[model samples]
Target chain A: MPDLAASSKRPPPWALRILVLTYLTIFLFAPLLALGVESFREGALSLWQGITEPESLLALRNSFLLAAIAVVLNVLFGIAAGLVIARQRFWGRALLDGLIEVPLALSPVMVGLAFILIFGRTGWLGPWLSQFGVRVIFSFPGLIIATLFVTVPFTAREVIHVLSEIGEEEEMAATTLGASRWQTFWHVTLPNMRGALSCGISLTAARALGEFGAVLIMGGAITGSTHTATTWIFTAVDERNNGAALGLSLVLGLCSVALLLLVEKLRARAHERR
Target chain B: MRPALTPTSRWSLLLRGAVIAWMLLLVVLPLVALAIHGLRSGVPFFWAAITEPQAKDAVALTLWTALLISLINAVLGTATAWLITRYRFRGRRLLATLIDLPLAIPTLVTGIMLVVLFGPMSPLGAWFEGHGIYVAFHSPIIVLALGFVTLPFSVRMVQPVLADMDRAEEEAAASLGASRLVTFLRIIWPSIGPAVLGGALQTFARAMAEFGSIVVVSGNVPHETLTAPVYIYGQVESGDSHGAAAVALALVTLSLLVTLFSKLMVRWGVRRHA
Candidate 1:
């Protein structure tokens, strides 16, 4: 009411507000509301028990391990690519930058299939590696490989964009001022990259937790072994065990929301800095 | 006095090289293997693999479903971004987050959410079934699942551009006797086209790649429903890696084409803006 007169200059029609509210309620809120309501319908304690159940725990454990491995791999990639694209004058830097986004635009199942076609027992590498008795598809190695494939660019993309904007003048100046390149990087570049690195890691971690298609296809969804939280949730829902599935989903949902918030904050700050 | 370049500089240079190597190892190599596998299997075999009456049907279904999702999301996403940016309303942040929630939620959970919202027992599900508009576990229903996850791309891509738009131009157009619709067409639209188109491509790519959610909802019938990704998975599981590679190659080619298309759109937008 206080700003009503101020809004006299540009008040969107009330109809617009009403329409937007109604649209979201139907398209976005309604279904998720169903999941949330049905899950807690039996009270939180039972849901908590479902979350702690051995099968649920095993799924959580497997997903966590898989996500951790994937994130570690991607972070190393992110730091490396971020460094090169930020500082190097390479012949193919532009092409490499373009290449980083290929995964984001590809289908997850296609990604899964790509992994299987390359690492499955009869795949090009699969047979050669099989000679060494290394199994990829339907194993932890497959899960990590697939997850890494999807996750590689998230951090690098984030870090590169950040690093690109932060010019090399500072690093070069520091290096010329007697600091070793390593020291200059650690003290200058690393500190500036802290926010991007954090954001990138969070994204990788969040996606790792939620990965399903690749893990399901390559990892085989064996109980207590290869089943990720997403796969476990899928199985539970399919088996008509809504209670346990919702409980498991809630856990992963919370992690995703948290990581996304961090990403949003970092990206917003970056945008504002511009 | 110039600070002496130390071993640190060389080491960091090597690190950058390693990063480039890593990108090749992680991204390029797997794809190369897939491509080589496709080649080894020969075009005759791939033609056989894909044209295996049912297999051809699967690829067609996947493309059409993805295309449908992209078309629907393009309209809805534009409407959403228009509302979110052009108006300041209650629950706007919640609306924004809800749209993007698909990006963060595990796709399998997305499937479960759809099932609960429209499965046999739910009120809407019952109504839809009663009206002979069964949405659960159906072909058209797959578009809905694809659209659910791809919805975020359009809005995110558009909102930032809209927020950055010059409203004075719109006002000037209106004062010059252009109706709101005409003003939007002449002024705002030219600016947002590339973004909307790029978003559409991303959605199409995502929809085609859909696995976790679609698999859950589609019931994965052979030619009637199985997507190319799922079809590839089936081949690999059946110990036919060569057949899988053939299909995987087709999927990868589609991805490359779509990505090039998106790049073209974004580049055109940049040039237009310039």
Candidate 2:
């Protein structure tokens, strides 16, 4: 409606198009190419073998276990939060929506530091939990907490937008027909968010697997126990084992790519549904 | 539609209240605690540490680096978003997914990816080092490397805005005899300007607090390359709890300001556009 755009334009001039393309190739593909090449180099096989060693495999196991646990937790809680914020016209709905993005904006290091102050030995709840002979810091539980804190919002934000668009009309109609509340939600609402849920979970899992800053602070990079894949990579680098670090990183990178791809595909499909 | 007065309202209200409560108590309260503890640890101690020439140097350096990284991403992220939204070239969808690679790739993995690609033995690393541009480690390469991770946020935030831009408006402008540059400047830029700035602010926020990726690549040299977050970690490890608290306070405040400012900017932008 603005007249400003009602001006003339050449068809994305050759120079401009070339400029954009050249910038894209340099900035986008260059660093990626560097990694893609090194990921399959001569020593990459030996590095792979090292990453599969028992200790290393344990790290990989810890990473997957943590991601699975966090993703499932976020999926349940995030969707619930999404539903409430999107459907309800509460006094603080806007506030709640904003709060959902807090973790996403926060740096991982800050999240880790917060976890320590709340759960570490000198932490607020640290003394409270110590009575139960439970250690919160330098433990696997701490790693999961760190991962969960940083990843909790991804699913919530994704699902909330989708739910808001899909709306309460369907649920209302189903309930009007004498469907049970739970039945209506399952039949009318759950089906509407399938792709969004998948994309959200994929992002959460991707984040959990790649968590390093929060995990490092919470677990002190402890190996074989609290060691996640990211922390393990850092430890390898600290020990000057670049190849081992590269091998672990390659696996993590691939997982991230796969999740991002899935999310992209779902986003495309979700747009069609809406 | 279903009747309004159902038990579903009660349960949904309860769930929503719980979420708001949880976020406030966990995320907001800790940030509050971080500030109070940071200040309570003593203004003298905080000033003493931060006022030292070296610490001041690190702070200034970090700010500039974050600014540079944010600026670079603002231009590049917007261009990339423009390309993805406007074009149907080969591999277009793939590029969209790949641009977000950093979001899911975990910051540490990103650092590791760079390490593999730029380490001395790798061809790419050797090429840079050979050219007297040693970007591998313990240099400004840390800023450049972390830049990759933060680029996705800016692009993701701006892309949708760009996509929403009415191409029909631009075409009309062209019909009226405006050049491409004129139309883009007067139309597209105005619509997306504040949004891009909002996204750039976010990029700046994340870059300022970036620790994991920078820590690995910067070598964490105390005066030369130690960012505030890394500095805090050192304090914790060295048992300088109060000093750590001080640094943490500053970091938290900076991010809090950026977040609040961006939110305001976004709202202002919306009102103006409306």
- Per lDDT, the best of the predicted structures is 1
Residue-by-residue lDDT tens digits, candidate 1, B114-137: 777787888988998999997887
lDDT of 1 by residue, A8-91 (tens): 234567766566556555556776787787676747987788788898888888888878887777777887788777767667
Interface DockQ per candidate: 0.43, 0.45
TM-score for the A-chain in each candidate structure: 0.91, 0.91
TM-score of chain B of 1: 0.92
Question: Candidate 2, TM-score vs. the true structure?
Answer: 0.90
Off by over 4 Å in 2: A1-14, B1-10, B42-46, B52-54, B171-181, B264-274
Query: Against the true structure, candidate 1 has what lDDT?
Result: 0.77
lDDT tens digits, residue span A156-247, model 2: 88889888877777788888888887787778788887777898999898988888888888888776688888888888877877566778
Candidate 1 clashing pairs?
A107-B209
What TM-score fits each model? 0.92, 0.90
Interface RMSD (Å), every candidate: 4.3, 4.4
